[model samples]
Target: MAQQVNPPRGMRDFLPAQKLKRERALAIIREVYAAHGFDEIETPVIEDYARLHAGLGGDNEKLSFSILKRGLRQEQLENAVVTGTGDVLCDLGLRFDLTVPLARYYASNRADLPATFRAVHIGPVWRAERPQKGRYRQFVQADIDIIGEPGLLAEAELITATSAALARLGLAGCVIRINDRRLLAALLDYCGFNAADSDRVLITIDKLDKIGVQGVIDELRGFGAEFVTPAVKLEHILNSYSEAACAGDIALTESGIAAVLPADLAPEVTSALISLGEMVAPGLPAGVRLAFDPTLVRGMGYYTGTIFEIAHPGSGSSVGGGGRYDGMIGRFLSQSVPAVGFSIGFERIIDLIDLPPAADQRAVALIADKAVDPAVLLRIKAELIASGARVQIATRTKNVRPLLDRFELDGFTEFANVRPEHTSMHDLDFKVFAES
Candidate 1:
């Protein structure tokens, strides 16, 4: 018996058809982003271990895959074991997300880059997560970030470009759920949660979609008696909105945001969100909406201002998301530089969109009989190529149906049967493959 081999767990191998589909979708994303004035950039897959664990990636830091130091001393190994820490043994790690790498990239290349750099990055990131249906240890993220701009204009551009990409991909009914870390902080303050425990409380609140309102309250109550009152207050406010909070149907207007929260709590945050909505409203396509979701606490701790996630009716989870992380680049540059970014969840969106047929209708599969002269087949293929058609030569089989099906699966639109008598491209009759 032969031993079975496969790709590593939580990863995958794409077949020819699958790879073509993914690339076509990615090209559409790149085209849309470039038209929106975002320049594409790339970064190394691995970064210094210290930087990967710099307390910037939130929960994703724990899932980062670390690389062991090369040629480590036995003493170093023992020390790491005795200390029960991998930090001493690892010097680098695979990135868990693109935003952190983007921050580092901007900080390193600032002198050469535009003062207000608008970047588009599409690449793979690795995590050590337990694999699930929609989750993978390795996945791709498409991100557009604007650095060095401090105002709402950066946020507006990110939202506009991201939404346009989704619309171009034919993903309809996408709702951009907006919020702010400042608003979440104010809500926590109004609910009487201790400032120090805000992050932990927000982590639980982030689970409101997974666990119902009562479930979130229960988890917070378990934190301590001090959390009980705040948890209940939070629940009461959410309950007032009933299904609206869960559905994320709350309006984006100032009055709409105020109707659900404590008076005078982060009025500036509400105002900024309202203005953001109005700024992007005229730019977005029909069927795309922008709404306020006070419960939308994006899990990242680095978001200083606006945060949002893109939701689609077809997916149980957000198809994409990003936010303003003004403080992140400063951590690398030692100087404050305001930045905002939006990331399209590439893996998720690809599953939802069916890219239109390839524009080139000239892909041809030349099926040559085994008895056909090789020279004749090559001549015909060259002629088709010169005429602007993509041509592939395949030997004819007993049943050509299976061969034609394989060609169609590989993106060939038409097939031509070649024989000794077929001396020129015009001598062979070409037939289109039935739509799959």
Candidate 2:
């Protein structure tokens, strides 16, 4: 027997039914995004390694894939690699995400584009993270983002638009789960942690979903954070923040506050953070909850303000997430352009909605007498082709039911070929469009 072949574990092959379900989801998402003035754009599947690692900081370096090609071509693939230092070689890694390439696109094409650009894209992205259950080494992220919009309303629009899109997908119990990194920073300062240590603290806490609260505490303590403070003497500082976060006015003495946070940051910054928290709280839509999760630190270092993530209580992981980045673009352009964006994990969303896994099949078989006029046959073929049927000419002696059974087994719903009467082509054409 010939050797059998199968896809790598955590990857999949979608047949007719599954492909249809994915198409349905894509249709709704595109419709919603287009209605909001987002023009569709497609970027390459590979990107330079620098872009992906730029925002990742050090936490996500292990998740990137490097390109082996050297020089300029390798330079192009560098951003796609999860991790690798020095000059490029030959093998280019696949893209880890879309945002890095989009940023590069914006910087390179600034002259040809409008000041404010809104783009929507749906495509595959790869990651080196452990693949299990809903997670995969390769998956799709349907994304929407607006650049050069500086106002908080732009941030609000991303959440609002995403909410509208999800609603169109039939999610009644979904929650937007908005959390501002600025607020987390302020709370962190209040708890007495500097920027470097603060980032470490947040990364540990962000894993709260995967690891329970106690697990987070254990991780934080392992990172060398102080277990006690003057205001609250608890051994675990995270619990103190968890409790003090609800109190409107929790103050610390000079030694109390100075021992925890950096003194270089202005005191007024803390006040402004408190006010922003109040604004985002009442601004959240009904059925959605907003909170100041001191532990809600996103892994991306580029985010500067107002970060948000979407989650369904019944689902095991975040469906999508985004945040404001006011300074990242400044790295490439002479002027800084504020930007914010979100990406919907298409695979995860489709799974959450319980979409069927299958692919659509296209097969057309035509059986007609050999004596039929060539002109007539040509005309018949043209008409079916115009109607978008994949017509296949077959011998008149061949049995159609058996051919149809094979089509059915292969996942083809629409079958067409040479047959007597107009009903033959019309019926098959209708079926193809219906599946489409």
Candidate 3:
């Protein structure tokens, strides 16, 4: 017997019904993207390994799927072997995410592209991570980005357009949480911490969702930073988003690691909060809530301005997130170019859309015997094909009832017998055959 085959763990195969549902979801996303004036473009799945890792900050180096080159000369193989660390070899890697490749593409071909390049790219991205419910090693990302427009309006447009996309996908009651790293930076500065410590503080606070509020505070204390603000002050700052209005009472606090903030920092933080409030408050849609969170330190080190994430309550994780990465393109351009965009985790959208599992079924099966004449078989197939049924002519000599039973088991309501009457192909109505 031949060996049984199976897909690698954490990978999935979408059958006809499931594929149809995914197509419907993609149609909604593409329609929304086109309606917003983003032109679609495709890129290659493979890229230079050096360009992939040049600007990606943080600990993401571990996530790369390094590819081995097989067509290398003796010297090239030696160089590749030298680079191997422990049991792992490194040379080329699967593109981790689409954004990095886009940055490289724009830099290499900026001359032919428009000044304000609005693009919609939807494709697969690979990450080697522990899989859980709704998380996969390989998945798809649908991204929309606009460059050469630096105003906050671009950010607002991303929020509005993404909200529209979700609504169209029947995911109406989603929450888009908004925050500003600059505001957090200013708050840190007001607390008398330097830039280096601020990065650490923001990174630590970013994990508040995973680890509770106290865990973040304890981690900060473990870092041995000077006590800048009281515990009450910290809690108030974190909890202020839930309140109706900001008040001065949030300023009174003196406790562990909280006393380090200067007295004048409160008014400055409050003023910045007021400015952001005016920008995001008026445009928010119904069933969506936008709030300023000090703890929303997006893991990407590139984000310079406003950062936000949209999450559906009871969903396993955030549906999608993107923000100002004004410096990523600068890495390739050798001169600073400001850019900001967001990516929709396509696999997550498919999961959240509530699609039924794809079941195996044949809408129209040719149950005729192998002894059936070739000319007669061709006529029946042509007739069924014209009727829009997926016709399959198999010579397995299986009983008709068994085939129909399998079709019924797989949720197919409509089935057609494409076999001709009395072994004659003479002038049979395919319409009647399809109806039957």
Clashing residue pairs in all predictions, respectively, total: 0, 37, 11
Better of 1 and 3 by TM-score: 1
The digit string of per-residue lDDT tens for model 3 on 184-257 reads 78776654556777767777777777776677677777776474453335555655432321111121112211
Q: Which candidate is the best by lDDT?
A: 1
lDDT of 1 at 119: 96
RMSD of each: 1.5, 7.9, 6.6
- Score every model by TM-score: 0.97, 0.71, 0.77
Ranking the candidates on TM-score from highest down gives: 1, 3, 2
Count backbone overlaps in model 2.
37
Per-residue accuracy of model 2 over 1-436 as CA lDDT, tens digit each:
9775778765778875578678879988999999978888888898766665565334555576667654556446565464653434434556777777777778998898788888897898877878798888788889998898987667656766777778777655665544467766766666666666777767766776577567766666665536334113222555545444322122223333333334544456344434544544455445454333334566787788867667676567777887887777777788888888987767878866753323442445455555655566667667776866555554565555665555444444554444444433443333342353
Task: Give RMSD (Å) of candidate 3 vs. truth.
Answer: 6.6
lDDT (Cα atoms) of all candidates against the true structure: 0.89, 0.64, 0.66
What tens-digit string does per-residue lDDT give for candidate 1 at 1-436?
Answer: 9786888888999988789889988999999999999999989999999999999898899999999999999988888898898687899999999999999998889999999999998899999988987899999999999999999999998888888888888999999999899999999999999999999999998998898788989999999999988888898987887468557688888778888878888878788998998899888987788888989999998999999999898999999999999899999877899999999988898889987667775799988888998988888888999999989999988988888888888888888888888899999888888743
Measured by TM-score, how close is model 1 to the native structure? 0.97
Error of 3 at 287 (Å): 4.9
